[model samples]
Target chain A: MFDIRSSIINQKKYKVFYAIIPFLALFIALFIGGVLIFFAGINPWKAYNYMLQSIFGNIRLFSEVFTHFVPLVFCALSFAVAYKGGFFNVGGEGQLYFGALTATLAGVYIQGLPAFIHIPLVLLTGFIGGAFWCWIAGILKIKLGADEILNTIMLSYLAILLINFVVMYFLKPANSYISQSEKIAKSAYFPKLIPHTQINLGVILSLLTVIIIYYFLYRSPYGYQIRAIGENSDAANYAGMNILKGTMTVIIISGGLAGLAGASMLMGTQYRLTPAFSPGYGFEGIGAAVMARNNPWGIILTAFLFALLRVGAGAMQRGVGVPLPISWTIEGIIMILITGSEYLSNKFSTNLIGGRA
Target chain B: MKKSKVFLRVFVLAFAILMIFSTLAMTAPLKIAIILPHAITSEGWTKSGFDGLMKAKEDFDIETSYQENVSEGELKGALRGYIAEGYDLIIVHEMGYNDPTLEVAEESPDTMFAITYGFKAADNVAVTSGTNWQANSLAGAVAGLMTKSNKVGFIISNDSPVAHNFLNAGFIYGAKRINPKAEVITTFVGSWSDVVKGKELAKAMIKQGVDVIYSQCGVVNRAVIEVCEEAGIWAIGAVEDMSYVAPQTVIANALAPTEYLVYGVIKEMVEGTLKGGRVVKGIKDGAEEITFNPLLKDKLPENGEEKIMKLRQEIVDGDITLEQMQEELNKQNIKF
Candidate 1:
C-alpha cells in the first residue's frame, strides 16, 4: 500500500514542492487561457493585459478587488478549518445565509443598545447561528452515520427556504413591496474604512481572523490533535484523540467562520438581508480553500487572487464589451489548469525520485 | 543548462508580450455597459431588460454591452471600467444595485449613470421605474371580473417591495374590485425564475379551488402559466404581454413596457431633455398598459371592454390620477 499520508506530511521536499504548486498552477492556467483567447478571436496576450489593468491598474479598481477579497477570506477560513479536521463542510452557504438572517433580525429588533454592544451582539448571533447549523450536520454525521456532503447540501436548501419564509412572514418592513428583511439599525452597521468606497472594517476583521485561525491551527495544542485526527482516524484513536469530538469542534468553528462572513455582509456591506445577498460566497470559499490546500495564509492569497479575477472580469465586461459569461469560462479554465499542473508536478517528482532510487 | 534557461526566459518574455498586446486589442469605442442582476439565459424578466437595451442601441447608434449574473461586489468594478473607458452611459438593472450604484456614481462623478428601480437620486444618477402596481391592479381587476369560481390565485416570486407594491397588492385589489366575495389565494416561490416551484405552487393553489391565477413572478410566470394551461384555468400575465408566452391559458396581461421606458430615456438623453431625478412612468405616461388576448376580447363582460377603455382614457386625461385610483380602490377596501 502507498504511504500517502507520510508522503504528504513527513517529506520536507514535498512541502517545498507543494509550496510552489499554487503559483505554478496559476502560471500554467494563464498559458492555457491564452489559447482560449486565441479561439475567441482575440489575442491572448492583450486579453490578459486588459484583465491585469482592469484589476491592478488604478486605485479604484484595486479597492474594488480588495473589497471583494474581504468576504472571500472569511469564507475560505471557514472551509479551511472544517477541511483541516477531515470534515467536508458544504453547508457554508446556508450557514452564511442564516448568519446574515439572524444578524439582520438582531440588528432590526434590538434597539437602544450602544453601537459597541449592538454590533458585537449582532455579529455574535451570526456566529452562533452558523455554528448551530453546522453542529446539527456534525451531530447527524456522528450519531446517524449520515453523509455530511448530502446532509449539508440539503440543509443549505432548507436554510434558503427558511430565510425566504422568515423574510416574507416576519421580517419584511412596513410598506415595503419586496421579500427582504428590514434594514438593520444604524448603530449595528460596520463603519466604512474608506470615504467613498464600499470597503469597510470587515476587511481588517477578515485579515485578523486569518491570523487568529492560523495561530489556532499551527500554534495551539488543539490544532495538533485536529491535524492528527485528519491525518489518520485509526492512529488518532490509538493516540487517545476523540475523532468524533474533533470533527464536531472543527465543523462548528468552520460554520462559525462562514456565518461571520455572512454577518460581515449584513453589518459591513448590505446592511440588510435580501434573498440574493450572497453571490455564492460559500462555493467560492471552497475554491479558495482547495486552491490553498487549506493553509490559512495561502487561503488569503488565493482569495485575493480570486477576488482580483472577479473584479477584473467585471472591468473587462465593461471596458472591452466581453460578455460576463466569458469571465466564468476563464475562471473554469484556470481551475482545470491548476488541477492539471498539480497532477503533472506530482508525476514529474515521482519519476525523478524513482530514477534516483 | 544555459540553453534551457535561455528558452525558459524567452518563453516567459514572449508570454508577457502576448498578454500586453491582448489587453490593448480589447479596447472598444463608445463603451456602454449594463449590469444585470441575473443570468441572461434565465429568460423573460431579465432578458426583457437586456432586449430593451439592445432595442435602444439600434436608435442611439452606440456600442452597447452588458454583464449578467452580476452581484454587489462586482458592480463597482464594472462601473469603474466603463467610466475609465469613457463610456457615456451605464445602465444598471435590479434594485440590489442601488447602494453600489450610488457609491460608483459618487466615485466617478463624470460618468452618467441610470438605475431602473428606486427613487433615490443623485446629481449624476437618474432613477427610472414604472407604476408596476398600477398595471398589476388592472390585471387583478380583470381577474376579479372574469373568474367564475370566486377564488383567484396569485403566484409571487419574492416578497420584495417591487413585487408586493406593484404586482401582488394590485392583483388582490383588482380581484376585490369586481367581486367582493372572491377569495385570493397568494403563494410566493421565493425566486424570480423557479418554474418548478412556481408550477408546484400554482398547482397547489388550483387544487384548493383557484380558477384564475395572476402570475406576478417574472420568468416563473411561465411555470404558473404552464400549470394553468394543464389545469385548463384562466391566468393573468404581468411585466410584458406574457399572453403570448402561454396563449391558450393566458386571459389577459398587464404590461410594464421596459422598452418604452428605455426608449423614452434615451430619446430624452439625445434631445438633452434628461435630468437627474426619479421619473415615475405610469398609465398616464403610456408606460403601463393592459393587453387582452384576442380570443377573450369579444367575450369580455357586456360593458367590460368599454369600462376598461373609459378608465384608460380617464387615466390618460389625468382625470383619474394614480392617487385617485388608489383612493377609489381603498374605498372598495382594496389595499393596492
Candidate 2:
C-alpha cells in the first residue's frame, strides 16, 4: 500500500514536469527566432516591441487581438476535445464552414425574431451544422471502419464547395459584386464588448467555453473515461468503459465547438457569409492545440500568442524590414520546438520513473 | 547653478530642433506599403502590382515596403500594422482585400488605403480595377477567328460573376460576333494555384472539340497552356504576357494592365491628386492592352489581328458598353 502511494506521488511530480515543458519549448522557439532575425540584420528587440505594442498598446489594437483570438479559442478547443479521446478530428475546417453557412442562412431567412431568440438560434444552428457534418465522419468511422482523419479532411473540401455553391446561387445579394450572403439582421449580430472596437460577445463565449471544457475534461466522470480510453483503448475496454459511446460523444462535442468558432466569426465581425472567411482558422486551431500540449488553459495562451504573431508580423515587416516569410519561419520554428520538447520531456520522464522504480 | 542654467538652455534648443525635424519628416515623401495574397515573383496580379510599386517608388522618390501571401483573415491586422507604423498609404493587391481594407480604413481615418480589383471605396479608401473585358474581347475575337473547330474554352480563377462579368460576357460577345455559331465552353477552376485541375479541365474541354482556350488562371494558366502545347492548339493569356512560357502554343495575351493601374494611382498619391473613390480604368485609360506573340506572327488567319484591333478601338472609344456585355452574359445565363 505504501509503495502504491509513493508511485502515485511520483506520477504527480511527472505531471508537473510535463506542464512546464510547453513554456520551456516556447522560450527556446522564441530564442531561435531572435537568432534568425539577428542574422537578417534587424534588432529582434524592435520586432518584439512592435508585437507587444499591437497586442497591448491601445484599446483598439488590443481589441483587434481579441478579434483574432475568439475564433482560434473555439478551434483549439474543438481539436483538443477530440484529441483527449485519441481521435484525430481533422474536420474542424469543414465543420467551421458548415456552422458559418448555416448561421448565415438562419440570420438572413429567419425574420422578426427578437434579439435574444435570434442570436442563440443562429448560434445553435451553426453548432448543429458543424455537428451534423462531423457526425457523418463519425458514423462512417464507426459503421464502415473508415479512418476519421482521411474522411474529415476530405469532407472539408466538400464543405467548401458546398458553401461556395450556396452563396453563389442561393444566398448571393443582388447588386453585390462579391459572392457573399446578405448581412445579418442587427439583432442577430453579437453585441460589442467594447464600444467602437470589434471585440464582441464572442469573446465571452470563448472564455465560458474554455472553463466549461476544462470542467468537462477534468472534473466530470465522462472525462475520466475519455482519458482512460486515450491512454490505452484496449485496457479501457477491458475495464468496461464503453469505448464506442465515448468516441462518438467527444467527436460530436469537438465538432460543435469548432462550429461555434464559425458563429463567433460571422456574428462578431464578418456579419455576412463570404467564401473563405474562416480562412484556415480551423487548421490554425490544430497548431494551437499542439502548442498548448492539449491543455485547455494552455490553448488560450497559445492562441493569443498566434494572434500576436499575426498582427506583429506586419509591423515587423513595416518597421524592421523583416520579410513576411520570416514571420512564418518563426511560427514554424516555435511549433516544432514545442512539439519536440513535449516528446523529449515525456521520454525523459518515463525513463526516470522506470529507473527510480 | 551656472552649469545647470547652461544645461536647461541646451535642452530647450534640442527640443525645438526635434519638433521642427519631425514636422518636416511628415511632409516628406509619403511612405507606402503593399500587401499581396501571393508572392511578387509569381507572374500575375502580384507581380504587376509589385513592379508598379517599384516604378512609382523610383519616379516619385518615395519609401515603400510589402508583405506577401497575406490571407483574408490576416489582412485587417496587416493594414492596422502599416497604419500603426506611420505609413501614409497602403495598397491592397487583391480583390478579396476589399472588406478588410475598408474596415481598417474606417478605423484609421488618417491612412489612405488603395485596393486593386475592388469596387467599394470610402473617404479614406480608393478601389480600382483594370478593364477585364476590353482586352479579353479582343483576345476572344482572335480565338474565334483562329479556331478550326469553332469551339473555344474559357477558364478563370473563380472570381465572382459580379467581379468578372465584363470579361466573361465580353469573351462570348467577341467570339459570337465573328463566328455566331462559336460554342464558348466556360469552366471555373475555383483557385489560381490548382495547376492539376486546370490541366484536367482544359483536357476535358479539348476532348469536347475546344481548339482554342482563353486562360485567366494565375500560375495554373501554365498548365492550361502546356495542355494546349501537347494537343497542338492555341491558347490566350490573361493579365500577364504568358507567351514567354509557351510561345508556340500562346498567340495573344488579354492584358489587365495591373501595373499601369497601380502606377497611376501611386503617382497621383505622390502628386496629392489621389482621392477616395472608385476609379474604373479601362481601354481609354490604357488599363487594358494585348501583346501578340511574335512566334505566331506568321500563323495569323486572314484579318484575325485586324478584327481584334478594331474591336479594341471600339471598346476604347466607348462604342461598346459594359452593360451590353453584361446583357450578353445574362442572356447566356453564365454563373459567376
Candidate 3:
C-alpha cells in the first residue's frame, strides 16, 4: 500500500491542490485588505470596485498598469533565472541601476546612429552593464567562495551612488536645472505601442523574454544541467556536469534580465537618468519570482498582481479617502500568506513522502 | 606771451589726465562670485539666481564666477574656496544653506556673504529673499473675488510656520478683504510630490464646496490642477506660471522671481548699503507678482485687472503690508 516510488506522491491530488493555491492566496489577501478597508471607514466592496475600475475602465490607466508590469516581470525573471541554478541573486537592484547608467550613457553620448541601430545598441549595452555587475558576484561566489547575497546588496547601493555621482558632475546637462542627466536621444527611445498611453516596445520585449527564458530553462541541455545541479550539486557533479560554468551562466542571464528592466524604464517613460526612477522594482522582482514558484509563465500573472496593487493604490486614495498605506497592508498580508503556505506545504510533503506515512 | 601760457596749461592738463588713468588701472572691478545648487538652464528656480548673477555683472560691471552642484555638505568648502580666491561678494544662491554659509562667513568676517531663501543673519551675512506672502495674498484676493461658493482653499505640503505665516495668513487676509465671509479651507498633504494625495485632498475640498483653491505644494500643483480641471472649478497656481499646465482651470499664477532678490542684494553691496539682516522684498522690488492667465484672459471679471493693479499698487506702496497681515493673523490666534 505504501510503495516508495508509486505512492511517494499522489500526482492527481497535488495537481488539484497546486491549482487551488493561487486562488486561496488571492482570497486570503483580499480578505485582509477588506478588513483594513472596514477599519478605514470605507465600504470594502466600493473600495475594491474603485481599485479595479481605476485601471480597467480607463485605457490610459490600464496602459500604465502594463508599464509597472514590464519592470516587475523582468525583475522576477532575473531572480528566477539564477534561482533555477541553485543561486540566489539578490543584487538585481544594483544590476538594474548599472544597466540604466550604461543605457543612459549610450543614449546620450553615442550619437549619429539611426533609430533601429541606436535602440538595440543602447539596450545591448544595458544588458552588458547588468551582466558585468552580475559577473563580479558570480566570480566571487564560484572562484573565491564569497557570499553573493551580501556582495549583491552592497554593490547595488554602489551602482546607485555611482550613477548619482557621475550625473551630478560630468554627465549633467549644460543647462540642467535639476541634478539629472540630459534626455536620451529621441531615436534611442522605445517605440510607443499606444498613442497616449505609456505602453511601449518594452511590454512586447518582456513577453518575448518570458518565452525565451522558458525555453532556455526547459529545452536546452544547459537548462537540464542547471536544474540538475539545483536539485543536487553532488549528484550533478558525479554525473560530469560543470557546476561552475552552469552557475555563472545563470547569474549572467539573471543580471541581463534585470538590466533590460532598467533600460526599458529609461527608454520608455523616464528618458533620462534620475535617482528616483526605480521604486524598489529590484526587491519587488524577487518577491514576484518567489510568489510564482520560479515558474516563467506564472511570473506574468504574479507581476500583474503586484502591478494591480500599485496602480490601484492611487485610486484607493482618490476614491474612499483612505490612505495609500492600505495597499502596503494588503501587500504584506499576501507576502506572509504565500511564504507561510509554501513552508506548510513542504513540511506536509516531507512527512507524507519522506516518512512513507 | 599769450600763446606760451596756453601751451603750458594744455601740457599740465594732459599730464593730469594720464595720472588719473594710471590710478584707475591700478584698481580692479568688483570681484563677485556666486554658488548655485543646480545648472543655469531648464529649471526655473536656480536659473533665476544664475540670471540675477549675470544681470548683476551687466548692471554693476562686477567680476562674476560660479560653481554649480555644490551640495550642502560641500557648501562650506565651496564658500571657503571663494574666500581664498579673493572674491569681494560671495553668494550661496539656494535655500537651506544658512548654517554652513554663516560658519564660513564667521571664519572670514571681512568677507561679505549672501544666502537666498532663509531668515537667518549675521554681521557678515545677509539673507536676501522674495517674500512668499505677497504672491499668495494676491492669489487669495483673486480667489475671494471669484469664488461663488464663499469657500477658498489653501493646500500645502506640511504644517510649517513659514507657510502658515505667509501662504495661509496672507491668503486668508486677502480673501477676507474681498469677501469677509469667505472661508479659507487649508489642508496639508504631508509631502510635496504625493500627487495621488494631492488630487484626493483637492477632491475632498471640492466636495465641501470650495470652488476656487490655491495650491502651493511644488510638484503636487499639477495634481491639484488636474482635479480642478476634472471638476470644472478654478485653481490658483504658485511658484511659477501654471496656466500652461492647466489652461482651462488655472485662473492666475503667483511668481517668485529670484533675479530681483539677487539683483537687489548685489545693488546693496555696490552701493555700500548691504546690511546684515533679512531683506525680504515683494511686488515693489520685483520679487513676487500675481499674473493672470492669458488663455483665460476674457474669463476675468470686469475691472479684475484694475482691481488687481490697485492691490499690487497698495502692496508696492507699503499701504498693504505683510507685517499688517502677520499682526492680523496674530490677532486671530493663527501663529504656528
What tens digits encode model 3's per-residue C-alpha lDDT throughout A1-357? 656456535654555676578768888988988998899888988989877876687676677677678889999999999999988899898999999989999999988899999999999999999999988888998888999999988889888777766776677665442456777999999898887566889889999999999998999888999999888899999999998888888888989988988998888766777644577789989989988989999999999998777767645653454455677788878888888888877677666566333
Candidate number achieving the greatest TM-score relative to the actual structure: 2
Model 3: pairs clashing at backbone N, Cα or C within 3 Å? none
Instruction: Give stretches of model 1 more than 4 Å off.
Output: A1-45, A105-125, A165-200, A336-357, B1-32, B61-63, B107-109, B179-181, B243-247, B295-304, B317-336
Residues B79-106, model 1: lDDT tens digits: 7767766777778887656766886688
Specify the highest-DockQ model's number. 2
Error of 1 at A111 (Å): 6.9
Residue B7 in candidate 2 has what lDDT?
100
State the fraction of real interface contacts model 2 keeps. Answer: 0.59
lDDT string for model 2 (B1-336, tens) is 999999999999999999999999877778998888877766677788889989888888798989887776667767766776788889999876677678778888998989988978999998888766777787778888888999999998885765367667778888887777788888888987888999999999999999999888778788899999999999988888889888898998888868888898898888888899998888777788877998898898877778878887888888888787777667877542
The residue-by-residue lDDT of candidate 3 on B1-336, one tens digit each, is 999999999999999998899988667677787777644542346666778888988887678777654444335545655665568788888654665587568878889999888767898899987777888888889998788989988898755445666778888888877777888899987555667998999999999999998888756787898899999999988777788878989999888767778888899899989988878777776779999998888888888777877887888888978788878767876542
TM-scores of the models, in the given order?
A: 0.84, 0.93, 0.55
Give me the candidate number with maximum lDDT: 2
The clash tally of candidate 3 reads 0
What order do candidates take by DockQ, descending?
2, 1, 3
Interface RMSD after interface superposition, each candidate? 2.6, 2.2, 19.8
Q: What is the DockQ of each candidate?
A: 0.37, 0.56, 0.01
